[model samples]
Structure formats: C-alpha cells, structure tokens
Target chain A: MKKTIDTSGQACPKPVLMTKDALVENIDELVVVVDNPAAKENVSRFATKQGHTIKNIKDVGTKFEITILKGGNKEETEISAEEFNCAVLPSKGKTIFLSKNKVGEGDDELGQNLMKAFIYSLIEVKNTPSTIVFMNSAVRLCVEGAEALPNLQKLAESGVEMLVCGTCLNFFGIAEKLRVGNVSNMYDIATLLTSENTLTI
Target chain B: MEIVITFKLTHNAMKAKRKVLFDKLSAEIIPTPREISKECGFSLLFHDSTSEDVRDYLDTNELKFSKIYLRAVVEGERKYEENN
Candidate 1:
C-alpha cells in the first residue's frame, strides 16, 4: 500500500510529476524522497493540492522523505491544466537582495534612474518576490526622501516582506528616517540570503 | 486620486522635486507612466489636492513640463487623464 519514489538529482516538476503518477496506482500512502529543497516543496505542494495529506516530512542530511497519505476517493483526484502551470507555484523561497542605492555601475545619475525603473517594473511583474532585503546604501531606498520610497511602499502593501539593515541605517544616520520595512540585522539577512533563491542587485 | 507631472528634461524634473520637497509639499518622484510621453524618464506624483499649487509652483519656478495627468481609481482599476 506504500510506495517509495527516490527523486534525488531530479529537477522541479519531475519530482512532483513522478509523485503524482505513483499516487494514482491504488497506493494508500506514498513516500517521496527529494534531495533539493525546491523539489521537496514542489512535491509537497502538488500532493496537498491533489487532496493528499502530508503525514510527515523527515530530513535525513541532504535528503528529505515526504510521506503523504492518500485522501478519500483517490480515483477522483484531478489537477486542472491551469493548476499544473508552473507559474502558479508558490514563491516560498525567493528573495531580492538590494545592496546599493543605484542598480549598476557607470554614471551615478543613470544608475539611480535604472534602479528606480527596475523597482517599478518589479512591482508590475506577475511574479512578485517573497522578500526584498536592503543593505548598505540600498537602505536609503526605504527611507523617507529616497525616490523609490513610493514603489517600495506599494510593494510592501502587496505582501512583499521588506528588511532594512539596521547597521547600514545607523551608518547612514538615517535610522529614524526609515519609512518602510522591518529593521533587520546582518545575521537575519545572511540567513535569508543563504536559504532562499536570492537575486542580488 | 493621484496626479503626475512630467517634465521635458530630467534636470527640470529633479529641480522641481527638490523644490517640492523643500517647500514641504507631499510629492514623490516615480517612474514616468508609459502612457505619458516626456523627455524625463521620471515624474512627480502627488495627491489631487496639490494639483493647482504644483502647477503654480512650476510656473513661478519656470520649470518646463510636457504634461500633467490625473490618475483616478475606477472600479479597482486606474485611469489617467491629461490635465495640461
């Protein structure tokens, strides 16, 4: 009644898809083993969406064993084509790291303009990042007078978590001027950057 | 409702922003909306209440602007209309 699928070294929906295939084989329970965090999360989310309950998730060193219990009427389990779209996957471990007030090298004015345009475009994008971490000069963007404050505020209002480095704020002498985001420390920032898929700008 | 003022040059837009901030006017410099054409890539956004004051300030300051638009919220969507 229990089936084991070792999806080690497999990518993305492959693990989720293989698990789905096993779920329909009249099995009462399924154990999916994935090596990467992304695969584990994908498989777990897929199982949950298909009306299967996760009984347990055990982490053994680099691997994870996710045990899922088949819900009632397994024959009725169906995931619509729209639901299977990868773009609809939850953004659980995505982070954007902003280290400077400007976006790129070259003329300071143009860099600043590019940074503003980047943040504005990010807000309009379909897939919003889960979190945006500001450090060093980038903390200025979250402060009162910075040009990008409004866009940062809009992003915050849309459920994007913002973390402004406390040390950097104090260094810039603008700690009190921070108008958005939670004050964070180096430790928390490092942990987030290491754990999540970070896009540095 | 929101109002956006776009300038013909980035320099003029930055100057207008500094003046607005210095005068304690509630305005923010944001990326110019794609629907509007202006030489400057950035625009100033503020509440509709300050529209006339902003216009007067820019006029008195000799800040050359391309256009001004009023952004209204209609049934959860934003609609922009040219004011000048």
Candidate 2:
C-alpha cells in the first residue's frame, strides 16, 4: 500500500517526526513532501538511516516529494528521529568593543603596538564586525595622525559603523582631532554593549 | 608591491619607525606576519617605490632590522618573499 504525507510549510523536526509516524503505521511505501531543503535533507537522512530504500525524489515547484520504500532492503535498522539534525543556527551581528588604546596587559609600548596590529588585522578578517565601539583611550585610534586611522577609515568606508565616545574624546582634549567615526553618547554605546554580540577588548 | 622590514627587537622597530617618519617616508608599524616569523614582533610596511629611500634612511640612522620582505597579494592573500 502507498501513503503520502504533506509536510509542506512545517518546520524542521516536525517533518521528520511526521514522516517517522507515517512509517510506523506499517505503510509499505511512503511519500513525504517538504518545503525547504534542510527539511528535505533531514527527512531523507532519517528515512534512509531506518534501513529503508529511497525510491525517488521529485522536485515539484518549490516543494520536494520524497518517495521512500519500506522493507525494500533486507537489513532494516530502526533509528530514532532525533538522529537527524536540523541545520538552523542563529546568526547574530558581531560587534567589537574597544575600551582601551592597547590590546592586553604587560608592556605598555608592546600593548600599543599590538593595538595597531590588531586594528590593521581587522581589515583582513573574512567576517568583519558590523559595529566597532571605541571608548576611553581607544578613541585615539580614530583621531588624526593615529597609527590606526587608515585602517579605521577603510573599515568605515566598507560600511562598518564606528561609534567613538564623545566624552572620551572631550576628556582627551582632542575632540576636534576626531577623524574617522561618529561622536556617540553613552546611551548609544550602552545600548550596543547590552544588546549586540559584543567582544570586549 | 609593498615591503615589510622585520626587527630582532621591538626597540629597533620603534627606532626604525621614528627614523623613517622623521625623514617623511611613508611607513607604518605592523605586526610581523606569521608567514615571515611566528614570533610576536613588529615590522615596518612601506611601498615598493620607497624601498631604496627606506633602506638608505635606516642604514644611515643605524636602525637594525632582521629581514626585508617583498609583500605581494597572491590569490587575494598577502604572500611575503624575503627580499634580503
């Protein structure tokens, strides 16, 4: 006997579970329909691992029709639905928080040089941060004649948002020396710090 | 093409930077690329056109350095070849 289950529009694990339930009903042949590619792969893997034969997969418009044959193979291995993994991973915008002019502790001069290299390397990374918040002594990095000015300018030109603290710039007495980023207040900085996927340096 | 001059010590690297800038040659201090040396040290990066100017200035000022590399972008990545 043949049975068809329309799992279209349903999210992951749901389609896998529904397919498993259909197979459990002792159906000889089952056709499972899913909307997304991930769902299709998950269901196909689940059914194949259960020692069933995959007869044919048809792409009908935006959905896929996967025909699975039960008892087609002599060696049938029963597997749990949990064996199939859903491929959806949450993607968040990354942010870099610079609170100091240097990168780490130890030698102050080395730290300063390291900071220059660190900022320079940022332009070379594959996944650049969506935002860079500069505070405290780190504000010097965005100022005129700063070693890191060119790199920061390149990042800004490439659409990376640079938020330089106004208070820090004022405190440093170089507010007019700002060269590459916006003069942001504490409220905006605090919001980004609390909400985004921030990496503090 | 660009040139990167690495130093045995950070002080020499800093001194080289001051010497190059005092002469008004275009250069910046960058971390030595791992392809050159795995050690955590500094290097001076300048344009290929200024290679002679930088070499002369550093030599005249007695700024000691370890190696000079010819930095080129190959397949969208920086590859350093030892110039001397």
Candidate 2, DockQ to 2 decimals?
0.68
Worst 10 residues of 2 chain A by lDDT: A72-81
Scored against the true structure, residue B81 in model 1 reaches a CA lDDT of: 90
lDDT of 1 by residue, A157-181 (tens): 9999999999999999999999999
Clashing pairs in 2: none
lDDT of candidate 1 at residue A131, scale 0 to 100: 98
- Which docking band does candidate 2 fall into? medium
* Residue-level lDDT tens digits of model 2 in A1-201: 999999987866789888888887768999999998888898888787778888999999999999999863335355444566665555655899999999899988778888988888888777888999999999999999887899999999988999999999999999999999899999999999999999999
Positional deviation of residue B68's Cα in model 1 after best superposition, in angstroms: 1.4
Q: Report, for every candidate in turn, its global Cα lDDT versus the true structure.
A: 0.83, 0.86
